[model samples]
Target chain A: MLFVFGHQNPDTDAIASALVYASYLTRTGTPALAYRIGEMNFETPFVLQAAGIEAPPRLPELAEGTAVALVDHNETGQSVSNLAQLNVTHVVDHHKLGDLQTNTPAMLRFEPVGSCGTILLRLYREANLSVEPLEAQLMLSAILSDTLHFRSPTTTEADREAVEFLASVAGIDDVASYAMQMFAAKSDLGDTPAEQILAMDYKEFTFGEGDDAQRWGLGVTETTNPGYVLGRQDELLAAMRRLKDKEGLAGVMLSVVDILEEHNETLVASEQEAAVVLGAFGVQTEASRASLGGMISRKKQLVPALEAYFEQQG
Target chain B: MLFVFGHQNPDTDAIASALVYASYLTRTGTPALAYRIGEMNFETPFVLQAAGIEAPPRLPELAEGTAVALVDHNETGQSVSNLAQLNVTHVVDHHKLGDLQTNTPAMLRFEPVGSCGTILLRLYREANLSVEPLEAQLMLSAILSDTLHFRSPTTTEADREAVEFLASVAGIDDVASYAMQMFAAKSDLGDTPAEQILAMDYKEFTFGEGDDAQRWGLGVTETTNPGYVLGRQDELLAAMRRLKDKEGLAGVMLSVVDILEEHNETLVASEQEAAVVLGAFGVQTEASRASLGGMISRKKQLVPALEAYFEQQG
Candidate 1:
């Protein structure tokens, strides 16, 4: 059986795209199962429940002989465990490529769109298959989540078109209102512990390996108001410190972005990371928190800026 | 105009594939020009002269606004100079990938075939376009040369089928006799100058840059009999030293392989490289030269063995 999956710490786009792609393959006479590398996050479960669709199974270790297709990610570190051992037949991704080498020539459909679900939407259209309402809703939720309700710089014209088309198919009259409801659900971390809050949207990036490796983490939390996170600074700081020590990372950056205001209030977990953030953002900082205006995208802005800083330092 | 070219040091496959692809694009109503990054080598001229096809234009400087498609090679250092400035529309290559990142998404058709011409052959069949007799001859010659008459380990079933089909189209009754004639023409390098002989089939492989970079040169000369090259060892050595000094390479290796016997006699220019070659091939050496039996294919055996050695050292 073909197991289709995405990157670890599965986001809405990764999980939804795998489900949609696996469904497409199944309908086209291929027996495939959709899987998630990690458990569903806070917002993803809400989206799946609203659409009346079951969550994909969490993937365990796969055998070397099993065939697989990748969605949303192409990096081996982010993909399923022991990715090189399995047969990778295809890659359908939207992110920048990493050091992914297949043993044989595989079909690669990599586009610079906002979400991998957008590519799946195009595939459905090309195959002349009518998408179910639940599938449409899942894809639409993926697009809204990844593009940050059209605020992300990663959003493209293709994403906009796909979002509109999927909205119509799902019978959603007001796209913006639905997106705000989903964002509010994601932002409602009132009773959740600080560690859970930090781990909700956490991601790690590593360059090199072993003693020469440089690794860092970024935890992004999107809220309607930034003060919600800044007010609980002490609790967040303790959790961030615990995570840094546990992971033995170079540093950690927690971004509390006001989605509506299109601004950011970043909390640096260590002095080393504070220096990097200062070099990257040139923003005002007092203690661990910094007030940075008009920087929303972690992919387009933060990661690239930090990578440039490290490359220069080297 | 769409400028189609290959890597520096244009081999038979590189030159012939560019010509074939340019012709296909032109026939399909695109204004394209075939260009070469380097001067023609010894065996390539014979292929073109026999087909009665003129050599492609030598590329000088390209404007930033120009459109280009790469074939055969994709590494930035080996590709056309100032590649980042031009708009790379497409890439069709058969080699392992390098650090190639385009500003925009480009059409990439990377196959693990024996030659770039083999990919072009599949493209022609997919488009249902009948190739001309001269073009068929050029492609057939390219496959034979790159796969070493199906002796190289990189040869696939697709290459074999393409060779037979192209042979039929080119009105060749005996494929083996034609391949031997081409090999004999390449092996007949007695009258050529030593410097020219070294430069004829030379290639450079590099990893990283600056002080951290490791750069090496490989000169492969195929002969029907081994004595033709072994007898002129002194002249070859002097020429190899001159090339090493001119190219600023870390080390240079000269491989004189007898095609009929499928054996390689490699000469190292330095002690450091001699140690590496000894470690890689496990062959005893007096001075810089060593005899390695059944190691003719540079792509499949020699380069991979040397790269493994360097990686282990790191």
Candidate 2:
């Protein structure tokens, strides 16, 4: 028996990717239990129920020989809240490569493309497993969310191609409207605090030279209205500022994207960091980077520039 | 044995969705052959190859007692193209409802949610099947293309939820850039003739008043760099008008859209049709109905408006 896991505060991509992976593995005669570290949100349950799929039991009873294959997020020794005593043997994630594990007989596949769901799709093919609809819908959802409804630069040729196929099988013709509604649903920040909204779908970035380590947790929060992007900038900035002051190295930016307008607002940690980076890209901005036609997702859209800036700084 | 089939001039959504369905069928115990009536273009190959999947065989030798499934587009009366003699036991698609045989013993599952792949995903789940990677990727791609990367208003809640789930399993944190690039790849129309470029993705829309049956084919041709959109509009319009005059469409509006800008120029045979239909949706016009955000897809985006206008005309 083996276990499939994802990170805490898991997003739609994480949850759905894990479930699909588990389903694929089992269909291929691979015994595995797909589980999450924390409770799945309302959006996840709705997605699974509608697709007629269910999330596997969370952290179910594991045998001594159980091997864990983590999905979406990796355990970088910074936290062990969920698996305090458990052991992970393999990992499948689609985030920036971290110093996850060097000694464990595990594999880490990280690419610049959008969702881990895509990676799982690759694995399914490599394993020669046939696809079923529950897993298909889950993987499709994961890609849509991670790519921000396919509006992110992190998306790849594979993504577009996959979407074309899925469009036929899913019986959906107006994918844009469906994507809008999903984002709108996730962006509705009712009762949730600014911090919760900010940290809801977050990732950490570590750039520049470091002796020990320097990491900046970056996240993008969406809103129902486009103007809400401006409304939450200050709160998000302050949070980034606190992290900047605390970490004291490199840049940490929060991007507020206007999905419909095809525009973005990148909130930088410091004017100097923005200055250093914008010069590399031939822009001058200290407040928020607002360009109408540029790509949105912070991961693929902004990371290359940030990396180039770090190289320049070096 | 089963076969997966789709409509003519199959768009990315129709083709990709069929691929996913075929993948699902093969992954399970049921083996299927994916077949199409028309041609496959440049961009589609990339998505299929990216996922290491193949489109269905066009004219595979079938055995007796073979079953076929209809997806995305369907036709009757004159013995369908890819499936003339086979037992079409199931019709799983997302299109304007057509004249399906009332007494045929077939499973009919159709929904209007932008992409047919979304419905196939549901069908797979209801049947307790699994969604493997390649199929998942295809379904996800279909959703993006059908939804215009999630910009149309016809997307349903079920479609939205399924896409969210699929993204995770596909395993990318960002998809927008991937979609944009795919669209951009298709957008490069480089000196091609107006008619050929337009046929890159042209579909027949059936509309009529009483006994008068009209079929209008709408398509778009794009170019890169300076004066690209307007420069090609005239030639494109002239070509479409030729079809309009020949086919006797009340109007054939080719909404030339700048993907990055989302602005489109609608070239129509009938100004009143553009006025009554496109105008009702707030599409701006310089010569014909134009809009900054007018959708480009004909499936869910245009059919609704056309149907509504036709209904109102009666």
Candidate 3:
């Protein structure tokens, strides 16, 4: 059986895309199973519960050369630890192409959309297959979660059409209301550890090439009520510091996103990270936080800016 | 206008794929012009003549950030000299993924098929567009050339089906005879210069990573009458030496593939390349030539072995 998974720090898109894509693959004669590489975030659990779907099991250790497929993300840093050893047979992502190398030719499908769910919907249509109700609901949830109800700058026409079609199939009458409910569930972070909160939607990236390459950890927590997250700023910063040191990362940042207002306030782990934020976004960091107004999409906004900054430095 | 071109040292598939895909994009609401990054091989000209299509113009000097689409290849080393500065909007290839990075998400469609033409056919079907006769002929010729009329090890079931479908669409009743005609045209290499012959179907690749990376130039010549090519072995070796030195390449090799006989005899530029051939393929080089029986496809048989060897050394 082929194992399909998404990036570590599983978000709603990562989890839902894997599950839907694995189902599609199995229906198309490729026996596959969806797997999660990391712990599910609050938003993902809420989405799954609402869809009435059981959560996918965590990925089990596999022998080298096991066949696998990746969804949502493709970068080695963000994937499974032994990704290089596994035989990656397919990748379906909606992000910028990363340094993903395969030994042989593989099926890679990428499109510039707001979420992987949008691409999966396209796949279902191309294959002449009808999306099941649960699959439709999961895809709808993923699109709403990733694009923040069409508020994110990364939102595209395809994403909007996909959400509309999926909502109809899922019997969701008011997408806006359902999106708010999902956001409310995501914001209900009651007593969760700072480390867990920081890892909810985290990703690791490498910039530059060869000797000049720098590995950085970027985390995001999207919520309708951002006050609760920012209130634990000290604990989050401490968690970021511990992660940076533990992972030997060049820098660490946590962007607390206010979904309703579409704003970002990033917490830096140290002065080095502060410098990176200042250089990348031209924003000053005070009290270990950088206010980035109207810049909330990490994939479209923050990561690209930081990549450009590091590339220029090199 | 968006520029669409294939890799340098354009082969039949590279040239045909760029032309057909550019036309497809234009018909689908995107104005695109096909171009060639380098000189076309002999077979490409013959194929274009058969399809009654004029050769695409050579790529002009493009300014930085010009939107471009890549066909048949994705590696920076085999692409335009200023590829890093160009905005790669799309890539349609059938090769293994390389270190290709884009600032934003791009439409990347890759599959482990025998030729890019097969994937283009799928695109046409998915778009619900009918393929014109000339387009079908071009794709047919490309598939036949790349897969060596279903004799090469790279040939897949999809490639065979595509050939049958394209031949019917192109109104070519005698498929085998037409393939022979194309091969005869490809093999009619008269008194071309040694350097020109070496560059007919050459590609540059970087293996390993970071500081340990080694750049290599691998060229292949597939002809039904391989005796003529084997007779000019010394000249080809001299050309490979000149190219290796001029380009500061780690090594250079020219594999003369006997299309009808299904065998490969590689000409090494120097002892270094000879050693590489021995280590990579377990074939001893005699008089600067390594006889690799039943190994005709460079992408399928040669490059992967060399990549593995270099990676092991690193």
Candidate 4:
């Protein structure tokens, strides 16, 4: 059976797109199983709970020679651990291509759309395949999450169109109300472990390979209050240090974002990385922490600045 | 009107896909013009000639606020020089994303197929649109060129399927025979200027930005006999020096590839870049040139090694 999965950290878009694409492949005569490489985050579980669907099976490992398909992400660094060993048959993603490549030519469906769910919805329409109500709700939740209820800069006319069509099919009249509910669901993290919270939305970038590889990981935690994470400063620092050591990373940073306040306070775990972050974002550092106002999108704002910083170092 | 074009050093796939996508957009109510950013390459012109069509108009400079759509490439460095100012509404390409970003959301249709022509063919079929015999021939030729008639490692099953469908529509029974004829057409470059011939299939990679920017250009000239290019070593070296000076490039290398022999001999223009080329490809140099056995693909073989070299340098 062909296994379909998304990136690590398992965002709502990642989960929903894997389900949708796996279903599409199976319906089109390919036997496939949807899986998740990591644990579901707070928002993704909310999507599943709202849709009353079972979570896709968590993939611990894949046997050698098993064919796999990737959705929502193409970065091998953020994908399965043994990604190079798997026979990647197809990749359906809406992100930029990373270092991922295949031994053979895989069917690649990469777009710069806001969400992979949007692409899957387009595929359903193109194939004249009708999605069930639950499927529509899953796709709608994914689009809403990735676009921040159409508030993000990444949202496009196609995403808005997909949301409208899926909303109608899923019998949702007030998308704003549903989005508020989802946002409210994401607000609770009082008792969660600091490491789990950090791991909820972590990404890594490796500049080199082999003996000269330099990797850095960035974790983002979005909530209604940044104070929640700030209160656990000691625990968060310990968690970041542990992750850096465990992953053999060059550095680590955690960006605690206040979604309602539209601000982010990043805490750098190392002095060298703190310099890089301060130079990149042009912010003042107070004890390895800096405030960035109105900077939300990681792919659009944060990644580019960080990339520029590293590139300029050369 | 939307002006659509591809990267510099226009190839058959770039030219044909721009034409096909522009036609699709126009038929679907959006008026569009297909353009090429650079002068036509040898093989691209042959494809247009065989299809009995005139080459697309060359784009010099687009006015500010002009809406543009990019095909075949998405790198701002490789695209129109004034790309940052244009309102990019769409991007349909099969290559890796470069540092191109739009201020507004674009309807991007990027795939990792062998050729952008393959994606355009799929678009035509999905829209229930009919392509003329000449259009089919143009797309067929593009697929053949990009995939090297199914010999390149980038060729996917989707490309093969598209090729079969397009060949039938174009009334060609023997694809091998047609490919041989096209290859024969490409074998003769008797009296072309060394600089012009080198610019025919050139690519650029810019690492940093602003004062710290590092830019390098790579050119590939595939021929049945590399002896012809080797005989003009002085002229080629002068051409490379002129290009490096005019473009303000950090370095430039021209790879003379023998298609039948499946080998490449890269000529370095400067001593600094010569060391880089020698170290990156791990080959012995004769003066300022090195022979790489069985290395034909710039994308698959040369680029990755160069990237590794640059990354390792940091």
Candidate 5:
């Protein structure tokens, strides 16, 4: 059986896309099982409950050379620990291409749309397979979560069309109200520890080449109430510093994204990270925070800017 | 304007898929012009002549950051010289994933099929676009040439289905006869220089990482008249040696594929190459040549085996 999964720090899209794609593959005559590499974030539980589905089981320890299918993510740094040892048979992703390779040619479907859910919808249509109600609901939630209800810069016409089609199939009306409710569920962080919050939607990326190459951790917390996240800035920064040391990362930053306003206020763990962020975004760091207006999408806006800055520096 | 093209040392699939995909993009409201980064191989001319379509113009010098779309290939070493500088907005390929990075998200469609033509056929269908006669003819020829008329190990069910559908749309009935004619045309090498033959359908690849990394050049010449090619083994080996020296490659091998027999007999340029091939394929080299039985596919068979051997070596 092929194991289908997504990136670490499982967000709603990461978890939902894996489950939907696994089901699509199974329906198309390939036996596949969905797995999650990391713990689900606050938003994922809400999305799963709304769709009346359970989260996929955590990925078990598979022997090297196991066949796997990747959904919603492709970068090695964001995937399984034994990724290089496994056989990646298929990849359906929406982010920029990264350094993931296979021993042979594989099925890879990627588009510059808002979410992997949009691509999966096209895949189902092309195969002449009807999307089950559960699959449709899961995909609909992923699209809304990833695109922030058509507010993210990553949003495209395909994503909007997919959401409309999926909403009808999912028997969902009042998408705005549903999205707000989802955001509220995500924003109700309660008393979650700072370390868990910092790891909720985090990913690591390598920039530059050779000796100049540096690995940095980037985390984002999207919520309707950004104030709730920013209020615990010191604790988050402390956790970030601990993570940076534990992982030997060059730098780390946690961005508090206001889902309604579609803007970012990032907290830098140290002066080194603050300098890198300032250089990359041209924003001044004040009291360990930088306001990045309208830069809400991490994949579309933030990572690209940081990558470009590092390339220029090199 | 998006300049769509394929890999260097363009083959039938490379040149034809670029033209067909460029047309697909244009029909879908994106202005695109097809170009070829290198000279067309022998079979490509025959395919284009049969389709009564002109070959795409040679790629001209474009400024850095010009938007481009890649088809059939994506590795930087096999692509245009300014691949890293240009903005790659789209890629449709059927090869293993390589080290191609973009600043932002792009439209990437890849499948483990025989040719990019098969993927392009699906793209057209998914978009509800009709395939023109010329496009159908080009894609049909590409599938035939790349899969060696369904005899190549790389051939998949999708490729066969695509050929049947395309042959009907292209108004071509005797596909077997046409494929033979193409092979005959490609085999009519006459007095072409050994260097030119070696350069046609050649690609460079890097294996391993960091201090252990090694770059190698691989070339293939597919023809019905293998005796004719093997008869000039000395000349071909000399050309390969010159290429390795000039390009600073660690090793070089030219595989002469017998189209009818469906086998590969490779000529190693030096003892170093012979050793690598022997270790990788466990085939003894006799007089600078090693017969790789039923191993006609470089992408599917040769490269993967060689990559695995090198990875194990590290």
Candidate 6:
């Protein structure tokens, strides 16, 4: 039996790749169990609905015979421990190398591209796996989510090639319309409970020193398009503060990435962190700032750079 | 010589697709000039930098011997005179069909998708174009932007498919990471001018019955994660009023498509238009009370319904 594993607090990319990977594995004669760390979020539901696959219920078994594959995130102490109780054997990720990669004996695979969905897309392509339209759509949605719908800097040529290939094979005439609808659906962020908002789309990280062992969970807070973003600015900041306090995070940062500026509206951990680390890289923390405006993707934009800062401190 | 044409004051989908389309055309052995309609925005700069290409200066000879390609919005009778003067041969778009299509006869291609970028990707593939890594990235970015980063309800299986195929070919491994960064980069909306915010990512439409013109624009006033769209309730109504005053429109309208719950936040000309048309179809002005909360796309989600409503009215 094979199992598919993804990071805790899964995003659309994790959900998408996990679903596609499980499908691929199933196609290859493996009854795979797809596992995620936490409960599913709103962003994950559509892909699951589109794929017509039930989320894998928590498994009661993980033994030595179980070969596991990690999608979207690499395996480590911090990685979702779906197979740790059993025995995971392989890791596939598209993010930059994580420190956990050094200690893991699993098939360490990390490619610095945009989405793990793309990684799984390559796997499917390499193995000549047949792609269903819904599965193709799921994989495509994952890529869109991961790459900020393909605006992130980390999205590479391989990502686009996957898009082109998948577009043709799926016989999709126009993807943008479909994707925009999906985005509009996903950004339905109103009247939701704070907890739901917090968990709706989140990424988790274990930062700080060995003794610190602080788990950081940061969720995005967006504003109204332009002028109204000014109105919601204070409310969003307050919400972020509440989340920060509730989570007891080392630093609760929220940014509003303006696609126009190519700069970050930085809400940093401290004035010192912003000045010393983020400022070193030119993230603006001006007083008149609306919010953290220029940081779009939390993974590629914030985590990686913040990881670098902590690494430098280490 | 190939010319990239975009409407004046381009949106994210238009400009980003133009940049990426330029790259696609270049890879297909057609050197393209990324002509700008106006100043670039955050999404454009990020896409340009990520694609490793720069938007070039407009060529004075766009009217002569130019294998002119138009993206996003198309030209109309009211369109800039230069468009009619151009040696235009091809057009790709994602908006509702406009007067420009019937009024003009350049290889008109309008796919009622969310973004024009998705159509451009199709053109590249249809032409058997060889794409570069940066080109793939740009194309994918354009797709995402048009799709509201894939949350919009109008998102099709095809859009997702293209993103996956292009991402893989472009070698974008972790699409989420890149997307997060880009999204984070856009989080700042504090310092943005009100007019700039209004125009930042707005779409305009002009539709008059016979002689007079009834024009309006719809802008996504707010968004966050997965199904929470707090539309700028009052402002959008005001903007519609302003458009009515400025254009002497028979009736101006503004719609906020909540893609998550699959409804619309509409501001129309009269209670006659609203009740006789919108109310019957369940479109309400009470956005916050909208039981249908997930209407996230304007092009695909809102336009068709409006067209149907108008047809029903007739």
Task: After the best TM-score superposition of candidate 4, give how far the Cα of residue B171 lies from its true spot, in angstroms.
Answer: 11
B57-166: candidate 5 lDDT, tens digit per residue: 99999899999999999889889988988999999999988888876788998899999999999999999999998999999989999999999989999999999999
lDDT of 2: 0.63
Question: What is the C-alpha lDDT profile of model 1 across A1-314, one tens digit per residue?
Answer: 78999888788998899898898889877788899988666778888888888899888788875789899887677887788678787678876656676544455566677888888887787567899988899899999999988898888998999999999999999999989888887777777888888887778887434566688989888887568777888899899999999999889889999988888888889788788778777775689988777778877777878766776666
lDDT of 6 by residue, A8-29 (tens): 6677777667767777778887
Best by DockQ: 3
For each candidate, give its TM-score against the true structure. 0.68, 0.45, 0.94, 0.66, 0.96, 0.44
lDDT of 1 by residue, B125-212 (tens): 7567898998899889889888888888789898999999999999988989888887887777758888887877777887433566
Candidate 2 chain A TM-score vs. reference chain A: 0.79
Positional deviation of residue B221's Cα in model 3 after best superposition, in angstroms: 0.8
Least accurate stretch of 10 residues (summed lDDT) in model 3 chain A?
A: A200-209
lDDT of 1 at A216: 90
Docking class of 2: incorrect
Candidate 6 per-residue lDDT over residues B182-280, each given as its tens digit: 544443444444344445555565433444434545444432221222334354455556755776645544444433333445455455445533443
Error of 5 at B214 (Å): 3.5
| Colliding pairs, model 5 | none
Classify candidate 1 by CAPRI docking class: incorrect
Worst 10 residues of 3 chain B by lDDT: B95-104
Ranking by TM-score: 5, 3, 1, 4, 2, 6
Please write out the lDDT profile of model 4 over residues A1-314, one tens digit for every residue.
88999999989899998988889999988898899999887787778888888999998677865799899887787899998778788878777555665543346665567888898898898788998898899889999988778766677898999999999999999999898777667767869998998899899976434565578898888776677788898889889999999988898988887766667888888787777777888887788787877677777677767766765665
**Which scores better on lDDT, 1 or 2?**
1
DockQ scores for all predicted structures: 0.14, 0.01, 0.85, 0.11, 0.82, 0.01
